[model samples]
Target: MPKKRILHGRIVLKDDIISGYLEVENGKITGISLAKPAISTETEFFDYGSQYIFPGFIDAHVHSFSNPDEGFEATSIGAAVGGVTTFVDMPYDRPHPIDNAAQFNQKAAKIAGHSVVDIALWGTIPKVDGVSEIPGLVKAGAAAFKMSTFETDPFRFPKISDVDIYNSLALLKHSKIITAFHSENNEMIVELIRRLKEADKVYPRAHMMSRPIIVETTAVQRLCEIAKWTGGKLHIVHVSAPETVDIIEAYRQQGVDVTCETCYQYLLLDVHDLERMGPRAKMNPPLREPETVSGLWQRLAAGKINYITSDHVPWPAEAKQKGDQNIFLAPSGLPGIELLVLAMFDAGVATGKLSPQVFAQLLATNVAARFGFKNKGQIVLGKDADFAIIDPSQTTTITDAGLHTRTDAITPLAGKTLAGQVTATWLRGRPIYQRGQVVAPMDYGEFVPGAEFGNQLAPGGDGLVFEA
Candidate 1:
């Protein structure tokens, strides 16, 4: 007989919150009942009382390999502790990016060996003439493609030229795979940074001043137009300014399949925090002013944003501290996969700005739908039995010493307190994290392929192949 277990809690469903118990058998949710079922000798049962039983959170943006010291083992462990059962790893690895089939396959193998929770991967193209690899990557199980308007590294995270962007989009227009971008105007930011450095203004605030809101809006607007023209699905990652959201909304209204996600820092922290915290709070498309943060919240409440992500980059202290006096020298991004769910609950749900259902949507449901993780996300029958059980009455204090990532001592959120605490996390009906311990094996996680995994590929001439 298949092993059976019962979990009782305040189940957070897609549309409603119910006081119910879920039945799990063979790692899948088989039945849900509002009333507790009769006890059976062969079944094990665990009751979580008033805690919220959320579908395991899915962070659509994570950088496990951005820092060579931090890899799948550390990031996935941190994710499990944060109640994130699965995450989509970015393609920009340290040595090389996943731009072709061989790289994608190698990364996929690494994920299966090291990750403790489920993981998906994003693919990208080379700096030029890389469109030909798209069909091969899709067949190799790349969840989506990521490009950039602003260049981070000329070779690894290069800015895609307009012509290449158009060509890539045209190729992926019918693949139903999203093409996400790190949208920022390269020329404007480069010029501003040059001027700032020349003037000897290396303060933390200068980082924001260098990459103003217009830098983001202009790039996003251009990408949206290209997506509209090519009919490609477009996604803007880590949107900070409200004006950028307005631009995305305008394009979305025109029937373009465009969506945007805002990081928790954008909604909860502001430029003031950046000025106060220095490089610790520093990230690309820097935090907006107080007014802009408020405006972003308004947009989120109005349902203009599709989802939220951590943009979790576990850069070592040396990488962030290098810019202490010269803020422009530090790399962008910070570690947040371990704090995203807890912090969001404290600010969005406990403050009543978001209900439990909406919180689940932003963190899990919408992410799954957007990234094509059909078997994960919601707490429904026939889905994987993954969950993040949160105790509303409990409190968690953030500290670098307590973090699971390799760069635990380098986050801006240290010493912060969040309202709720994740009491336990379940992945595929197995307890991966509970009572501050990671219970799963290092190789327990598996690679989750994207929506275009097994599609047929055929020649479309000009040395290009198209999904048939």
Candidate 2:
């Protein structure tokens, strides 16, 4: 018989939270009992008492290589400390994007060697004729395909043409794989920024003015129509407006397979923070007004939004300092993998606006189901024994010096006190993070293939030969 381990705690399940114990054997959950079970000398027992045992979080949006300084090793360490067992890395890497089977294979190899926690990869297409590479990447185990309506970099992150978008959707109509997008109107944002620069309005608020809510909503609406026409599944990332959720819901009601996710910053911080923190708080689809932020919280509580993500990007201080005088000069995004779970639990659950079950759904369950992580995201039988144990009585104060990421000073939430501290984190029944340190080896993580992986590959083939 395999060695068994039993953990006793306040387990948060799919429908309820109960005082119980969970049994693990060979890295899989074997049994769960609401009442305490008999512990024998053969089974190792660990008691957490009243601490909450949540399913290890899954952050759907992450950019480990966006800043080459912060690669899989550092990012995965931060993720483990934050109680995230699995994260889906974006395809927009620094030197070269993963847009083909060869590039995807290289990245997968890197993940296996460098990451300390499980990682799933996203793939993208090149600027021109990129849709042709989709099938190959899908076979290479890409969790999803990401495209952008607004071009950040012409070669690294290009805006997909309408024709290409339509073609890609049509080709993937039957695959059931999600094609996500950075939805913002490029033309409108460019024109607005041109005018702002001409008027010398380079203040922090200019970031919000250049890309308003209309820019995001308009692009989302167009994508929804295309998905409607081709029957492709669609996802919008880092949505900042409440009305955008309304738009997605309207399309969802019409039977279009459309979903949207909001980042934790959008819920915890408002446009005021963008102005207050300047470049440090800069991000694409900039933060919304305070009223809009409140409306977004209401939509989240109402279950109109599908899930939440960190959009974890760790840019250096110099990158953000460039925008100290001109907001647009700074690169967008901030580090969040190390703080997403703690911040959300403090603001949402500790405040009594959200229950523990809803918190798990937003951060873990929905992300797993949406991204096709079959073995993760729950604490039930047959699932991976991944957990984030939290002691609610303890509080954590965010600080740059305490961060595990490379660029710790780039976040605006530094010094914020959050309720509940992560006491330990387990990945596949192994303790990866405990008592403020990562205990797992760098190569402990494994690659998680997408749902369409098996269907795309030919049987008994080492190379990517598409199945007819």
lDDT of 1: 0.90
**Compared to the true structure, candidate 1 yields what TM-score?**
0.97
lDDT of 1 by residue, 202-304 (tens): 9999999999999999999999988888777899999998899999999998999999999988888988899998988999889878999999999999999
Candidate 2 colliding pairs:
none
Error of 1 at 87 (Å): 0.3
What does candidate 2's lDDT look like per residue over 20-46, in tens digits? 999988988989998877788888887
Candidates' lDDT values, in order? 0.90, 0.90
TM-score of each: 0.97, 0.96
In terms of TM-score, the best-performing candidate is 1
lDDT of 2 at 117: 91
Cα lDDT over the full model 2: 0.90
* lDDT score of residue 467 within candidate 1: 69
As a whole number from 0 to 100, the lDDT of residue 400 in candidate 2 is 76
Off by over 4 Å in 2: 457-468
